[model samples]
Target: MITISVCMIVKNEEKVLERCLKSLKPIADEFIIIDTGSSDKTKQIALKYTDKVYNYEWQNDFSHARNYSFSKASKDYIYTADADEVIDDTNIERFVKLKKAMLPEVEIVQMKYTNQLQYGTTYNYETEYRPKLFKRVREFMWINPIHETVNLEPVIYNSDIEIIHMPVMSHANRDFKQIQKVIQSNIRLSKKLFIMYAKELFIAGEDKDFLEAKQYFQNAIENETRGLDEIKAAQCVLTKCARLMKDHNLLLKNSLKNFADNKPSAEVCFELGEYFFEEQDYVEAAIWYYNAAFETECELNIHYAGDYPLKQLANIYQLLGNKELEEEYNRLFSKWELPKSPDA
Candidate 1:
């Protein structure tokens, strides 16, 4: 049997610490928590789970903190999670068997992170695979001061494990002063890092931040060396920025035009649908929206694929007074393999 240690770095996470640790307790053999100057009961709560908790002064460099956490692990494998992330109860059994069944040759394990980004009563989700689990003794190392990830891409085992991120609804944790400080500290702006900088600022939900977000995203898109996924993501962000600024000209002309030039992505397709939908061009909008929901060779399934397009399609078909067409689309929504939204 293979042993797995769970490594985590936290600060002032008292609210969700117990929730995260509780779910992981049964699975992890070694729990290493590095608390970076928390004033809250986070350290005390961590001690309830393991005496492996240690104090580290707050550092703006995330990779350094993560490397410190990894260095304390004594198990064959290391799995990392955020204080706000929870492993699905359904995935626990599979995870255990996977731990035992994994071959020694496996260098890394990729698992999905489910981020539920809420907008009012409507909930939208975004998912991405990350190498959250890996062999502790391998040649793996983390990089980056913000949004750090392991550097090596050795033979990877794609696991069914999923971590659901449940962030508090309050704005207290929204401040990114520490991250900004690090960014301003002469960090080299790689394409991925650049996108994260923009995303963090854009998520701040201020007028000035949105403008900066637009500028950064446009710059990221123009760089041309980013991966397909990152480029697609930047395009989507630019589209959102255009919409927020109410710059319909940029939405229809600049943002969408730049994205369409590269590839046919579900994200750009969905935006096109919204563009035509607002103009009351139901026929054109429906065409683009259908591609967004059903197109297989999109930039990525999650890139443009979500419950939004399906919901919009049903609305459009119903608007056309075609009950039969609406039912056909409704069936697609009901039968979607991935988790569907409540109203979708």
Candidate 2:
């Protein structure tokens, strides 16, 4: 079996640090924790695991702190996680197997990042498959201050392992702060940064920032021919911004072309249906809403493609006096148990 070094950077995480360390004690070949000026007993807890605990002064850059943590690993493979992250038994087995079978040429290993559950709930878990394990000798480095990421070499392998994140509490304040800091910085905004800023603003519920995000998104649409996913996401953000602004005419005007251009996404169709419903054109609203629900249901059956909008369809049907359809949608809504609010 390949030896694995577990590395982490922490501060004021006394509450969660112990749980995180305990989860991996049995699996890890080595454990290293770098405390970035913890005023709490975080370091004390870390010392129980290994002498690899070191002090790293806060430099206002996550990359700096993480790179320092990486320097201490001496195993064949390096694994890292936040104080709030955990690994389950199944993934532990997968990790062990992957380590045993992995070749030296593998620079990085991407594992599933299981985030939230139910797709839309506020307190629900969020999950995504991400690169978490690394080949130590490959010398993978960390990048970015906020929203830091591991810079991996081109040749990589994916492991069917996972990292589970379980926060002691919600992160709304920190989420907004990160974005606000980025926005306030006197730095040039790349297309990616623009998108990030926009999303943060949207999440922060700032209308002015959302409009700025829309402008950046428009610029992105004008400049790029590729990145269909980002473009589509931006278009959707713009659609929501329009809805929030209650500019029905503008929402209809800007989104109509895209709705017609792409095979109508459930979200897009629902927006159009909403616009028409507000206009008291129930027939058109019903048509668009029905199509939206049908497409979503089909996609859901084929793949776990849609959520919440399925419930919205039920709500719209309730408005349209369709008892049978409403009942059917209600059944699905209960089954999925998606968030009651879109913001959730």
Backbone clashes (count) for model 1: 1
For model 2, where is the 10-residue window of minimal lDDT? Answer: 297-306
- Per-residue CA lDDT of candidate 2, range 83-190, in tens? 988887887777777767888767777776666442222222254456677877655578799999987545667666777777776554554455456545744455
Residue 99: error of model 1 in Å? Answer: 7.2
Report residue 145 deviation for candidate 2 (angstroms): 42
Candidate 2: residue 256 lDDT (0-100): 71
Q: Which structure among the candidates has the greatest lDDT?
A: 1
Output candidate 2 Cα RMSD: 7.7
lDDT of 1 by residue, 187-285 (tens): 656655654554444333455555555765576577667766677667666665676677877677545564555555676678778878988999999
Candidate 2 has a TM-score of: 0.72
In model 1, what is the error at residue 121, expressed in angstroms?
16
